[model samples]
Target chain A: MSTERGLFDLTCADFGLIRGITESWDHLLSRSIAAVREQFIEQCGLIAQAEALPRIAGRILGLMVFDGKDYSFSEIAEELQISRGSVSSSVSLLTAMGVIERTAKPGDRQDYFRLSEDPYTTFFARARNRAERAHKTIQETRDAVPKDKREIRSRLKEYETFYATLIKALDSGT
Target chain B: MSTERGLFDLTCADFGLIRGITESWDHLLSRSIAAVREQFIEQCGLIAQAEALPRIAGRILGLMVFDGKDYSFSEIAEELQISRGSVSSSVSLLTAMGVIERTAKPGDRQDYFRLSEDPYTTFFARARNRAERAHKTIQETRDAVPKDKREIRSRLKEYETFYATLIKALDSGT
Candidate 1:
């Protein structure tokens, strides 16, 4: 009976500690702002998944881009409620993609990350590259066709024109 | 021994029939054209998957777009070597998305599918709609932020402007 009482008391103390931590976090970041941030981050994650990228990478991007501030590596893991390992790999991926960049504060040894300058331009340039590749594929297909197949050649030409126009539009817009 | 011999003859006869069918198909559609069409269709399927659309639907679109002609439901299934049910469902999906359309010949009882007259325009319009949605999401997020958080609001406004510019570019190009 004494041991059972002691266990119950310990559970109560742990619950109180958890509540205290949550309350402090809520005080630092308002509940409304947290909710908004979560929604925005989820949306960006969905967008990234649609592009065949990792959802966590997109969420990391959302955090930095929406906050418009650099976050230390540990802070990112803690604030996003994700594993440090996940944060590390995703940061590397975003860095390699040129979507985000890493920096350091003068006295701080920990790495910091922020959205890259002109990420939208980089994204559009990637689109242009994909369009160019498609254009080249279509052109090669056209070349492989015999000269006698006029109908097929003409159709392939039309596809080439379409991709060329799309590339030009991306170029001008970017 | 006679039974084994009979099976061997049947196998040879089947092989000859298969070769003959292949030769006729090659005559009707040259081997080179077939190879090019397959590559183009596969590429379209990849693009469709990237956009979160059904890959088979994209292949159907590629066939019609590349050939610049309508295909009957049965023809679509046979040419793409997919099941009839898959073709039917994907056709419905593409029709709903306004990426492809169905038509009927004067004497034909079957459904024929073709690329919409302005499919690229439709595609761009869909992109603009997505941009608009992202913009709205950002705006709502911004509204939820407290007035004291000026920095977050400013960053969200920048995102809104980026999406707005994108929408405008898509509008003008389309």
Candidate 2:
């Protein structure tokens, strides 16, 4: 037998993650994978390494991709062992961003939800739309702000222009 | 007058940023900036949008640069309005990474600290050291683990090799 432990083979009993994961009713490694995966997709700029917000957000998104079936609000909250309020808010945000679909399930009063199969495209669409608006606003500021007092606006304009042009080129070429 | 907020004219508020330098300390925008800036410097790879972390870390470092003199733990904490524990930890991490120096002032029991110049070089040294160890560990695992069971190790080896070489080159450079 090897002296080292397999990444997933080790139990919560062997580590604090297991203790927390089990108590939280989650698989720690699985969650870590999800969190890491989210960062790869969004690179939203690093935040506190102490708390993995990406993984927290990822788990919520991953859970929505539940087995071919749409889930209700209560069912999701129960499964994730999280508050209904949290699920509601996260779901609302995801829905507004078009990465999750929400509708009434047969014989259910609560909204039913499912992950968007093309979450990458949908998510990017939402992000791109926001980026475009920001770019426009920044450009507007650049034009209207007095020349002597527009350093920040100039910086914002540079960023918006770079990203806007880059994404457009990507869309056209891809 | 154009309908856009002009330069940093001592008093313009950003939608997400505190407009005036004298904006109320109690405002959410100001608090958000303080928090974001804090996370930014401590954790690298942050972009400008990291309006909080990078900004906070930069400001703290900047403040230390301005003083160019040792500050008691309490003094720095009070200036930033953060708790002593946080100051202690941030300072400790900075010291370990060689970003700051710690010492006891003459005839004073309390330890005082100041930012160490050329923190960029020191920061990369710490990071490069970490990357080397992680790469070596992963390379060892790839060599030992069963072929059918070592896909993660294998992929890690490829990536680690690429990064290790890159970091090594950077270290040897300049």
Candidate 3:
């Protein structure tokens, strides 16, 4: 009788502590909201949108980040109303970008995906890098063309200089 | 012998007058390449790259100002290497943007386009108006969403703020 009572008492104490921990965790809870962001894990959806990922990727990011738990590929596809192929491609890109991570359940052959701690850092940096690379290629094109060809090359060089100048100016401010 | 002497006398007088004119107009002739004062007219290309129309529209202003010539739609499309459909759209947009104008050629069915002499003033004013219109729409979107769904609304607000801030910064820059 005493052991049964002790177990009951212990269970009740654990439940009470759980409630207290949640009640005192305003900062931690707000991380899931917009306030206490640790490198903006919460804004995964917004970051994904600016990255020009397909709608499938947006839902995948949203579910993985906001759904409070990791999800398997098939499960996410069903949730997002996308095909498994779409889910695979979206998650693959997100995983490669380090925005989403993959894990496997014990004894389960299939892997699951979840959001990373710093989604926006990858989002902005990768996007900037891609644009900068294209900018470089365009500059190369401008240079490879000969001079004095009816001023076409001159115009290309001028535009390339302008873009390089503008992006730098914007970067300096931001 | 008298006829030959008469021809020689006439040639000498013509040469003296030609030398006088050359000496007087030497400065202008020195500045003129090919010894001709060929005017570079800035014509807006009727057809433009659709994907690049907006950015190209701005560059067209620079192109006209720099090259001092009017470019036909086909010429612009060929130079830019974009489809005629795209150039068509861009020229239309630029016309609407009021940065360029269409000129009619007598007996020519196809219209020629050129940069407006007053480009900067109108483009700046129009861009400001566009920013104001965007701000109003953003404000409306914010108001339309429920306050409790702050996460979604706040992200959108941040995007709007970024664009608004960008416009302000650009407008302030020379």
Judging by TM-score against the true structure, name the best candidate: 1
lDDT of 1 by residue, A11-116 (tens): 7678899899998776545666777788889988877776567899978988987788889999999988999999999999989888889999999999999988
Docking level for model 3: incorrect
Q: Write the per-residue lDDT of candidate 2 for residues B25-115, one digit (tens) a residue.
A: 5333334434433433233213212322333344455446433567888888787787777777767766776767887888888888876
The TM-score between candidate 1 and the true structure equals 0.76
- CA lDDT for candidate 3: 0.55
Taking the tens digit of each residue's C-alpha lDDT, what string does model 1 give over B82-111? Answer: 999999899998888787899988899999
Tell me the tens digit of each residue's lDDT in model 3 across A1-174: 354654346676788998888866743343244332222322334434433456557556555543446788788877656788888888888888886799889988888877676553454344345436545644544444444554655554554554465455345435
Query: lDDT: which is higher, 2 or 3?
Result: 3
What fraction of the reference structure's interface contacts does model 3 contain?
A: 0.00
Better of 1 and 2 by lDDT: 1
Model 1 misplaced regions, further than 4 Å: A1-31, A106-108, B1-31
* Candidate 1, residue B70: how far the Cα is off, in Å: 2.7
Every model's DockQ: 0.24, 0.04, 0.03
Worst 10 residues of 2 chain A by lDDT: A43-52
In model 3, what lDDT does residue B80 have? 60
Query: Candidate 3 lDDT, tens digit per residue, B122-145?
Result: 533543555465455455444544
